[model samples]
Target chain A: MSSKHIVVIPGDGIGAEITAEALRVSQSAAKKCGFSFTHESKQAGGAAIDAYGVPLPEDTIEACRKADGVLLGAVGGPKWDNVAPELRAEKAILGLRKSLGLYANLRPIKVFPALAAQSPLKPEIVSEVDILIVRELNGGIYYGARQEAVIVNEVEQAWDREGYSRPEIERILRLACRSAIGRKGKVTSVDKANVLATSRLWRKVANEVAADFTQVEINHMYVDNCAMQLVLNPGSFDVLVTGNLFGDILSDEAAVLSGSIGLLPSASLGDGTGLYEPIHGSAPDIAGLGLANPLGTILSAAMMFRYSLGSEQVAAMIEAAVDQVLADGYRTPDIYQQGLTKVSTEEMGQQVINRLK
Target chain B: MSSKHIVVIPGDGIGAEITAEALRVSQSAAKKCGFSFTHESKQAGGAAIDAYGVPLPEDTIEACRKADGVLLGAVGGPKWDNVAPELRAEKAILGLRKSLGLYANLRPIKVFPALAAQSPLKPEIVSEVDILIVRELNGGIYYGARQEAVIVNEVEQAWDREGYSRPEIERILRLACRSAIGRKGKVTSVDKANVLATSRLWRKVANEVAADFTQVEINHMYVDNCAMQLVLNPGSFDVLVTGNLFGDILSDEAAVLSGSIGLLPSASLGDGTGLYEPIHGSAPDIAGLGLANPLGTILSAAMMFRYSLGSEQVAAMIEAAVDQVLADGYRTPDIYQQGLTKVSTEEMGQQVINRLK
Candidate 1:
């Protein structure tokens, strides 16, 4: 079988420290499963700016286009804060998503049985929680047409238009349904139809799309109730789909649900290509100290194998290895406990690799 | 001294049960504090619909406008569900708010020390939590200019504008600051300034407003961050002010923070009149069962005294009495404990009245 091609862009700060370990762990998982892997490193963000005077050089975009999947570590730090605001370190991901035509962002929130005690919710509430959130990323308020401050009726006023055409809402709902197909087969489309016109339109589209997926049970809830449920009854939700603004808020709230934001992995997918990465940001102060956590990135590799590569067995192997290591009380500095064994980034990666069998 | 005029609208269902106890509790507090009270009962919701053929009758609005403050119980039930959706039981409050021009909606979330065990969050996290959320109810997305669904380029689309004129934002921020003045002297103005033009305008206006209120410390946070902070650090916030859309979502999230949604109260104030009520809805299932909780409505009466009737001492007296009753292990059915003494709605009201001295 031909080796799967993956693009590695360890953009800045601790990006380099963690991506190396993630790559090692990916290779170990591939070896244990009798599969071959091929990958290439590319310059982006601050590193690309130092070499080519731009955060996202054309060559980097072209390289990602040629690969089957893209794996990114954290991006942005104080050192590049003075760059032109448009060319700042964070734009690399934004530019990549637009250039790759990625629209749906998948963030899975699962309270690991071994680490359920880390969450703020009572143990019983977090015990049975596994949620997949499909957020429509390319449209809505963030990408809406806007006008700067203008005098209206002798008062300073500014507004941004929020709109979602049928195509945008349909694709996202379809993606959410697809995500729920192999799980509990439940999808909850969240909106503010009681207030916003955009939400009413979104809800109409959702109901229309839901009719085609008869096997999946669908529920529509107001965004406010959904936010409360995330805290009050998080175990009740399966797959949640929403517009960009609500998604941004609810996803962050869900990230906080785990109490392990630094160890979470996310995937962005379009109709054609997929991109996987860790959810944390670059830690400039400890960039070279080998103190950065690599589990998020290693898990991102697992996501790549399951989503972009045709290997569910390899993905499951990598994920099980991570679970095995955590069960042994092997902890990184970010998630260290008083009695647990603390390991550096490389050591933690090695522990998982050793458990891959 | 002249007696304060109070209009009582026992709207429907549990609304009648709770408001009767609330009115009784108010009379007890007034008697203990040597203040005279003059009150009138008016019909609204389904009651008004049966008598005057409208959800919000003109006589009810006229009475509320002439009074010093309004004490309302819950509204809406299945009885009026078949009414024209626009003329349903729930529209009474909406009609009242628009007619009364009540722009500032106040919801206080304070986890009572005696009942902190009711919260889903660990007791340690809920121990020091107290928050006042002031939502601008008249403007923002709910009342903005909107275009209904229209096909453009063969795809259906709809949009709602989100705009805040200077005066609208200023008055709400001023109200929030005033709310903080008597409490912790700190305010947090939540917005989404980084992405939305309306939020940027809100942030700029918030900063300008902060300069005028030198005695109180004000901080600005993005809406997404505020949502997470509500769960992660509820105790750190004193007062939160935001536009209607964000507020509608965040205030509900804050309400969940206390784990006693059934025991929460709210107030809506304009320049001329004030309206007070509990945060929960009329549970038709428990309409006249004597099982409804009355503390929330009774507490709303306390807010009425402090905010509209100019009786902070009496308000404090009423609040402390309720707290004492709870501490003594007196529980209503909604909040009953395994071994605590259970009481009917009016019995609990009498318990609070007995503690008023």
Candidate 2:
């Protein structure tokens, strides 16, 4: 049996609770697939900032670097609200993404058949909604320069710089196109090319690289229209590629369209090891109350299996288990109903594991 | 009876077709309301570009400036695909916005109970979907500079700049706040304040302005999370105030949630004269086919009456006519299905006009 080492980061709030659930589910799937997995727990985010005075400890990064894969529960909470925004819990996640050179943030929006009613959109419109939004994670305006609040003639002066380099745009675009080719053989490169010059470059590069994927149908939609189309007709899209700023907004919109943010998993990958996490943030209000949904975290574990550990069968088994659990009417509070039984984080994890058996 | 000069610039593609419908409906509504509106036809957009080699002609701008109100059908088409992007037909519309100082772009997303079935979201989720998205039209990353593809050592280089000033942020925020005060009295300011300095300033200024609206509940949401929330729980939002970039993307999304982009209208107001236009672009593909949906353009006419002419009653009459028409089960091809009464552009216009009587 092949053995893979995975780093588990239970950052803050519901992080610790969901991290345990994901690990338990992963262990069961790994054993069934004839693989042995070793888990190393580490402190990062708000928890690390509290314990080590640094959001991301040096030792934690080193351990993650040496690991075959990483599974994160969630990060940030009001507990870190008093902390300087830069040294806040989110900084650790951003730092990991930057240091790991995790250029592509792949968020898959899938409307599982069982939870389709939870979507705010018409059931017919979102029933089988499946879209992969490849967002450029580490670049664009997120890391751009700052001018905080400037006082000119007693009035505040505020400015922020938004700039992007060629290499940054190209790499994200190439990865998005390659991912698109692997799926529906179609790619829609979105940008505000008419007004933004950076978007024009994005348009040009996307077209240039699209030529490389002759088998894939390459299309372009303005970022504004793309947002509208996602609500109007989501099924028309398969793979979406865009700049970092746009990806951040569009992917979140796509996530909610999938019915529950708690049901989606995301993978941020680059030059080093992959970091798998749920698209949803840690809900401090619901943390440790057993009310937090762990399905997103478990799904992240499945992604780690398929992408990092090279265990497609194990990943599929884990996915089937999740579907079966939902099909059997087990619901988390976030998606709970009166008649349908609501299960806690631990119970949901156990239910999936039992179904896997 | 007071007579208002209304500039009707039916730019290109189905713009001309739709504007003709708007003229008939507006003239009929004006007559019924005992008001007189002199409609002046002018050329703009791709049609203007083709005939006069200029998207925004001096005469056209002058007509809009002199008129009491301006009603645009739609602009832009692929016919000018090879043309310099700036000189394209869309620029005339954008240029009109800049010249007119149209800063606040108000897009209302209202799901009609009659056509709710056309929405992809479950009818229950979309039934009462009514939101007003106040987009800052003039500033943000939209006007940012860009250095197109550059070659250095056989490698390409590209850079785009996104910059915003304090006053620009303050003015737009104030406009958004004032607009919110009239509606459901809730303002959700969306920005990237945590990451970008411009957002920090935007947040600071918006907070200060929000303090003035004592009755309105003001909340802040990041642009990404705001987009997701828009889909996840549509009812939670009433009026959303966002920057130019976020507004451009979100307004389109909100429009589609209502079932048809064909039923949307937008108004852009700045320091000078306001411009009203349909959110749907000129569909040259359906140009002479008479298949264009004119409701958006007609609704734009209603917005013109309310904002520029300051006649909310006339606007309400037009809106009521529209609502009743939909209630009567009249559907255009874009929204029509079997068993529904389908109407053409002219028939739809006449139907609304007849209802006004």
Candidate 3:
């Protein structure tokens, strides 16, 4: 058995309850797959602010850097709303990503067959949706230099730069191409090539990178069209990749198509240790009440196993168990339908554990 | 009766057919409301390329500049696909917008009750969607300074600047607020203030401008959240205002929510002549077959009455007639239903004309 280590950050609100369930489920699934891993709980977000006066402590960053992967149960809440800009709870994730050198943000938007009715789209339109959005995290307009509102030529204006380097686009595209392998083998590289210079360069680099992956077929789409297509024909996509700003918009748009955001997980990856988390924010309203959903966190753990722990078997086992659990009609309060069995946060985790093969 | 002179550009493919129907409908509507308008036929797009060797001829620009307003049919077809970048058929619209100083692009996305089933979204969710998107057109990243791919610090990179002036943001927000006055009296200013400098400035200016419209209620939304909400609860929005890039995207996304792009109309307005057109492209395959839908063009004409021609009564009459015609089960090929009366493009135009009171 290969032994690996991980850091867990149960940041705030329902983070504690959900991360506990996810940790237990991860242990059970790893045990079933004959895999062994150790995890240490760390402080970050509001919890870290309360403990160390900073949202992201140096100690936590050091631990995450040394670990194989990190599992975060979200950050930020109204409790930390008044914090200084640099010390805000949400800065923890940004700091962690920067420190860990995490570049690509992978968001898998899949509509579970059992939950298809929950979608805002017609059931037929969303039932077959299984899209993987590979968003380049550290580049593009989000991280580019910006100027605040200032007087220029007698007019007050603010500006931001949207830039992409060949290496940045190449790496993210390579990851997207690799991600498409063993899946649908289709990658849609989205940009605004006709209008933006960075997008034009991105398209060129995308073509160059995709050439190295023979099995992966790639096509380019404008960001605006892609936004419409995600709602119109989401199933037509396999791996959708774009820069930070477009990805931030499209992934959130795609996430809502599932209609159950609490069940979606996200993974941030780079050359070093990856970070995993639920797409939803910390629900301070349901903190410690066991009313929150733990599946997103558990799915994050599954992604951790696949991307960082080198245990695709364990990841598959966990994911299949989750699918079976939902198929069996066990639901948390967040996803509860009238005729289904409504389970609590812990009960949902145990249900998945019992079904793990 | 006051008389107004307008220029009509029947650009390419179905442009001639649709514009002719729209022109006839507009004249009849105006006549019913005791108003009169004179229109001159002008060539642009591929037609201009054929006639004057330029997609946007100096004559067309001068004519449009002097006219009260401009009504355009769809532009571009495969025949002009290989034209030089600057001479492309699509350049005609861009050139006209620039030359005429049309800076605001308004796309009204309203789901016709009779065609609600055609939406990819559930009928209940889409049945009440009526949104007007006010997009800033003349500025933002689309028109920003850019650097093509070049070696920077030994790595090839490309960049584009996204800038917004107080005047630019203020005018668009003012337009949105004014647009909301008669309808819901609500405006949702969408931006990415949490990320970009331009968005922060946009939000600030939106607040300042909206303060001037005391009757119009306004709120701010992150662009990503707005994208999700447009699908999850589209009926929640009244007038959504945003910058150039965000508008181009959200408008198209909202257009698909109607599921009948052929029936959607758009208006670009500024200090001078407003440009009105349908959101759909010219369908060359069905160009001369009378199979194209003309409701979008007619609706665009209706907007011309409201915004440029300064006859709200004529605009309302044209719009109500359109609504009643659709309710009476008259369908064009693009929005046809099995049980409804499928009419030719010309027949559909005639139906609206008959319904005009």
Among these predicted structures, which one has the highest DockQ?
3
Better of 1 and 3 by DockQ: 3
lDDT (0 to 1) per candidate: 0.89, 0.84, 0.94
Model 3 achieves a DockQ score of 0.90
The residue-by-residue lDDT of candidate 3 on B1-357, one tens digit each, is 888999999899999999999999999999888999899999999989988999999999999999999999988999999988999999999999999998899999999998899999999999999999999999999999999999978999999999999998888888899999999999999999999999999999999999999999999999899889999999999999999999888888898999899899999999999999999998899999999999999999999999999999999999999999999999988788788899999999999999999
Which pairs of residues clash in candidate 3, taking residues 3 or more apart in a chain or in different chains? none
Q: Cα miss at B323, model 3 (Å)?
A: 0.9
lDDT of 2 by residue, B1-357 (tens): 687888889888888878898888888887788878787899998889888998999889888887888889888877787898778787898788766777788888888888787776677777767788888877666666667767767766565555566777778777777777768888899888767887878888888888887887889999888887777677778889888888888877777777788898988887666788888878888887878999999898898888887677778888899998999888888888888789999899988887884
**Taking the candidates in order, what DockQ does each have?**
0.80, 0.63, 0.90
TM-score of the second chain of model 1 compared to its true counterpart: 0.98
Docking category of candidate 1: high
C-alpha displacement of A348 in model 2, angstroms?
2.5
State which docking tier applies to candidate 3.
high
lDDT of 1 by residue, A1-357 (tens): 657888999999999988898899988888878888799999888888888888999998999988898999988888889999888888899999999999999898888887878887777878888899899999998888877778987889888888888899999999998788988999999999987889999998898888899888888999999999999999999999999999999998888788787778899999666888998888888898888889899888888898888788888998899889989998888888889899998899999999997
Give candidate 1's error at residue A109 in angstroms: 0.3
Ranking by lDDT: 3, 1, 2
Q: Which candidate leads the pack in TM-score?
A: 3
lDDT (10s digit) by residue, model 1, range B1-357: 648899999998899989999999899889878887899999899888888889999999999999999999978888898999778888999998988889999999999988998887778788899999999999987898887789988878898888888888989998898888879999999999888889888888888887888778999999999988888889999999999989999999888878788789999999877999999998889989999999999999999999999898789998999889999999988889899999999899899999996
